[model samples]
Target chain A: MNALRNAALVAVVAVAIVLQAVVLRYVSVDGVVPNLALVLVVVVAVSRGSQFAAVFGFGAGLLLDLAPPADHVAGRWALALVVVGYLAGRVRQDARESPVASVLLVGAMSFVGTSVFALSGVLLQDGALPVDLTLRVLAISVLWDLMLAPFVVPPLLRLVDRLGSDEVAAARPVSLARTS
Target chain B: MRRRRFGQGPTHDGSRRVLGLLVLAALTVITLDARAGDGSPIDPARAAVGSLFGPVESTTAAVTRPFADAISSFRTNKSLRGDVATLAAENSRLRGEVSTDPLDRQRLAELDGLTRTAAETGYSLVGARVIAIGPVQSFTRSVTIDVGTSSGVTKNMTVLNNDGLVGRVVQATSSTATVLLIVDTESVVGARLGTNSEIGFLRGRGSIADSGRLDLELVDNAVVPSGGDVVVTWGSQNGVPYVAGIPIGRVESVVSSPRQSSRIAVIVPFVDFSALDVVGVVVPQGTTGDRPVISTPTGKADR
Candidate 1:
């Protein structure tokens, strides 16, 4: 059972990483590319509960930051993901009734999170992104999350439940293994 | 990396527990490396991953470029077609007309004389094409060009497009050379404002393409600056990286900053960089192999 659970978690995250890496303009609205990995992290974190979500989110963020173009502080992503994971864990049960609702919530959260990240980057660096580009990024990112939810959320939830009743407890050790 | 099994225990820190631990680890690394600048960029692990992914990104970009163009075409086909027609009409008109204005003819004559005089100087011109750019580059802009040391394009050579000064070559590999553009926040060049001949350093403020302005800080803001004012690089001791008069940019706007000694201006570059296919590289009189000179925003923070 533990082995199956571990494999399931690994596969989900591995797929997300590959998608983020290989795809460009995965969903385009106004020439902007939305970051789908962020959406996935939010969804998985919220639906699967916190423990698993935070760990997986941090791992994902670390990989995302490792990309050459990334300019954040070494663990900026880890910190962001950790917070998102915790936020997802604390979301009320009434709000996450349906997949579409969950996706919308996740997408909104991703947009806000990305804006915060951008602001943080600007404070650290000298240049500022134009106001329009910033807005476009948020809008397009939300659109992508909404568009990709059908594909991302159900499988994530199934995998989590299949892992065990201790949706939060069984999540840790297995995620760590896949991360390594 | 062994995973600790909590044995299905109920604990609130379930993930925060581990996250706190990771955060602690990351803080340790950041604190240790905050003072170490050079070591941060040379991380072998990070380099290996970036290199591995860079080519993949290139291939993807190459494949998607056509699609992107197609999308662009879809959005403004009519306006582009109209512009083409208007340009064709203007070209025909210029070919058919002969200007008889004495002042205009005299100005043309003087430009011709200046060109001839400039031609008398024996100088080598190296042409190159710009390639990719590092994503993280902002304040200290660096661009890769096709020309290299092999093509007589050495370090410290100035790069120019049809409009004005583009940048100076910093380093060269076998087939490629890196240039630090004038828009880089760190680059500072001696510049004269318009016909005023007011000399000051024109520094690169990095490209914020969306803003449609280049950051240029002048020595003084006391002089009234309106649009259409030209900025040129002031001649150095001996001709090399830049000649006596190369038009760099036009003043787009002038505004005051609360803390700085000078007022900053937005400079619109003469060259349309997006379509740049060729750049001229001029070898300065004495090239010191572009000694590890720091771009302003780069090394000074520590000092």
Candidate 2:
């Protein structure tokens, strides 16, 4: 049962990463696309414990980092998302986050996650990475991620809840009760 | 008051252990990939993963592209309709004057000018479709195009649409290439104003909202390009990066100070960088036939 659930999570993450790399790019505004993968990682982190979030984030991030058209050094996103997933997971699973609150959290996490990704590139002295560019990107990215949250997060949470009912119920009985 | 329970359940301790292991694994991967230098141990894994996902993405893109195109066309339809009306009116008026001597001379001169501009550039074009734009988090003003080495695309080639300059190729794989847009803060282009034929440097502000406008600076203190003056590339020696006579932008406003030797102007680029779709790359002239180069005429007074 655990193995099946884990496989489901991996499949979901894989599909999300592909959509992010390929599909969502078509709708970019001013070279800014919503960080769908980051939002998914955050949702998983907030609903599940840090442990599951961290592992899931690392896997998702690795796939993203390895994806084609990825210019930065490999594992940059993995490292960034791991930190994001862990931090998001630390916010007690049972605590109720209102819709606005969840959106705000996703927005903040997107900014922080992007910062970590850019900072890692900068630290590696990737000469192309500039501080001002990073800041500008962070600002626009946060808005894009926030805009996507209301649409993406609820559906994803519902799917996860439906697919892995036993674990989700064990993790947050209150959320299960509310949804049911 | 009810208390919040954190990390409860049967596998709590095991979860902590997994988290630690994951973190360590991520750190290790970052290190290994970074230090690998010219060759990466993980490139094959990445390539394999990319291959696995590529087909699905292509299929999805192929399936949904028409809807995306329809939406985009709908958004631009009104503006396009307005342009069509204006052009039709101008064409009718021009047709009425074809028999007049002065109008004939003026039209001939305009044709000559366009011919000279194209001849001066001496470029071979390769057309490509934009596949993906940069993610907002990367803050990189770039786009990936479907054509790459297979289509004779190489790094540093100038890219443009019908409107004007779009960007330059930064990286190229066998099947695709990434273009660094003119709006990227790091991009710098040598430009000449239409009014005085004065040359200057154009730099991007790198703002997502302000990307449509670039900063034109380094003009001689004595010559200030007026508002609406056209800007074009100065072209590099042998046209390695940018060819001469490609339209860039028009001056929006100018700023000057007596203390400084150079004047600054704001230019609104002709290309709509935000809405790029199909673009042409100015690749090297093929060896079979060399293009004839013509000297472009000097600047005319601003209208």
Candidate 3:
């Protein structure tokens, strides 16, 4: 069961990466595509807690870094997402309690993630995009992620809820039954 | 109950430690990649990931293409409507020209226009479809094509569409290669003015959203390129990265200031980098044996 759940998590992240790389290109606004993979990491963080989110974020981030057409340094996304995951996971309790908070957390973390990634680019001098353009990309991405958060977070959380229930019921029936 | 399983399973300090470890690992990887430069050890891992996900990306691109087409069509519906009259006029003119010219001559002319630079320069062209775009997180503008080393594509080969110069092949695997678009901030192409052949260097401004213009600075200060002047690639030594005489774009406007010695012209590129789909890779002359010939514009049957 644990192995199956882990596999499911990997599959979800992979699908998000693929969609971001492929499908999202068509829906881009002014050449700025939304960060679907970052949203997934936030969802994972809010639902699964810090340790799991960090590990998942690292794996997802590494995949994104190595993904084709990615000409930047290998670990830039990994570095940004690790911090994003840790921060989002720290607020997991608040996020779980209130849908609004979870959405807000996703929005906030989107900014952090985008900013971190852009800042890394500036530091490494990866691409010669001017500061204003970088900030413009940052603002647009945050808006994109913010608008996408509500649609993504709730459904994914519910799905994660259903996936967790099977394991939770088997592991600790007494506590889960009482809570329900 | 769910909270207990995850939150309480690992102590708070344990999770913090994990985060620190992951962050450190990421930093180490970044430093290693940066220091290694061209021969980075992470390249093999990157290639492995590319090969693994390349098929998935290609499949997804194929499946989602119609929807993408619909969305793009809807977005461009207004502009498309405006273009209808202009296209109609041009069509009639072309029809008149076709009737006046012999059928064979017209066909050759059409082929010549389609592969203008390649045909004129005698390059063998291998066409490929764009599979996926670069991740938005990276500021670099690049696209993955469906052809690779298997199709005789190698790094630094000039890529172009029917319109004009696209970019160059940066990395090539077995079945896919990444083309770094000419509009990327990091891209620099040696260019020459269409009129007097004044030499200049064109650098991308990296703004695909608004203007998508490139900055052209001539080596000689006195040469002033007027508006509407055309630009083409100044051939490299062996044409490894860029071939000569390929249409880049027309100079839209010139930026002249008293303090600056040389004239800076903003060129709007011929190829639309945003809407890249099918593009051709310029295969070298002698290496055309293995790959099936798509088009040999130079009138050569086989090299």
Candidate 4:
């Protein structure tokens, strides 16, 4: 059962990364690709807890870092997503189980995650991308992530709840029973 | 305040500890990867991931491409058809002019480049479909092409579309190649203005949010290119990365005050980067001992 769940998680991450790279890229608004992986981490964290979120974030980030044309110091994303996942998990523990609240949390976390990633790039001397450009991308990405959250996060939560992860079940009862 | 209390509770300490350890591990990986200086330790893992994921991405792209094309065609098909008809008429008229001026060296030189670049320069081009884009919010502009080392693609080879220079190949696995688009902030190309031939360098603005723009820096501050002047690649050592005479963009507007000692112009690139479908990788002809460098309009060797 554990092996099956792990395999399923890996499959989910792979599919999210692939869709982000292939489909979401072409459907970008002015070049800002919607970060499905960011939303996935946030959704999983909010659905589960810090332990599960942190572990999943690390796995997703490692896969993303290893992806070609990564163009930054490896593991910067892992560090950033670790913080994002933990923070979202904290929010999940405290906040009400409302879609609007979840959207707000996701948006806020997306901004923080993008900022941390950018900051790591700068500190690591990755490249000489201007500061203004980085901030603009962060802003657009936040808006895009929010716009996509309503569609992605709710459905994904529903799917995971149906898949019946014990960690997810103990953390929060399935509130998205009618999302699909 | 209630949330703050829960966050600080004894049970939460374990979560915090887990977070700390994860962050430490990530930082350690970053430090080791950076200091290692060659590449990451997980290169084999990376290659495996690429091999596995690349095909799935390509399949998805294939399935969605027709739908994307249909949507685009629905929006622009009428106007595009009209334009095509107009261009056809103009081409026939140009053909008459070319025949009449067959001996005109200037017209012939211009026509030579249009006929076949592979014939003109010894760089053979391998056509590839753009399968996926880099899925991050960072300044790295890269795309995955269906072709790879299996199709003779190599790292640092130039990629271009019909409009102009795209970028260079950064990584090529067996069945996939990753291209770093010229729009990447870190991308810099040696370029020159069309009208005055003033040499300069064109750098990518690096934001997909602000596409079709590059930062142009001139070597000579005294020479300012007029608005609408074309920018073309200035070529590099043996043109391994970038070849000569490929259109980069047009000057949209000039930045930097004339008196302040900086000449910077905003360039609108010719290629529609956001809608990239197919591209070509320029690989030098095998068995041909070094071809002569092509000359620019200003009578300077592009290399």
Name the top lDDT candidate: 3
Q: After superposition, which runs of candidate 4 have C-alpha atoms over 4 Å from their true positions?
A: A127-132, A162-164, A167-180, B1-5, B8-11, B35-44, B74-115, B120-122, B195-197, B209-211, B257-260, B287-303
Model 3 per-residue lDDT tens digits across residues B203-247: 987766547889999999888899999999998988979988889
Candidate 1, residue B222: Cα displacement in angstroms equals 4.0
Estimate the TM-score for candidate 3. 0.85
Write candidate 4's Cα lDDT for A1-180 as tens digits.
977877787788888888788866645655677777778888877766666788788878877776765655678888888888888888775433678878888899899888888888888877546777677778878988887777677788776555557765665554555333
Better by lDDT, candidate 3 or 2:
3
Off by over 4 Å in 1: A1-32, A46-49, A89-97, A122-180, B1-11, B25-34, B77-210, B223-226, B232-248, B257-261, B270-303
DockQ per candidate, 2 decimals: 0.15, 0.32, 0.44, 0.41
Q: For model 1, what TM-score is found for chain B?
A: 0.55
Task: Give the Cα error of residue B132 in candidate 4, in Å.
Answer: 0.9
Evaluated at residue A27, the lDDT of candidate 1 is: 20
lDDT of each: 0.54, 0.69, 0.78, 0.73
Candidate 3 global lDDT:
0.78
Q: In candidate 1 chain A, what residue range of length 10 has the lowest lDDT sum? A: A22-31
The better candidate by DockQ, 1 or 2, is: 2
Candidate 2: tens digits of C-alpha lDDT, residues B111-209: 454444434555556656676666656545666777666667767888876677878886666566767788766678988887678898998766444
Regions of model 3 farther than 4 Å from truth = A161-180, B1-10, B77-117, B257-260, B286-291, B297-303
Q: Over the stretch B1-303, how does candidate 1's per-residue lDDT look in tens digits?
A: 333433233546565686677666545533433335445742454445455444444455445433433333332343432132343354445433423354345445543433333244333345554444432211124555655655556556777765577777755554456677766555677888876877777765455243434666666678656777998878677655566677788988887777865777777877654333356666533322322211123222211
Give the fraction of reference interface contacts each candidate recovers.
0.15, 0.50, 0.69, 0.59
Kindly provide the TM-score of model 2 when superposed on the true structure, using C-alpha atoms.
0.70
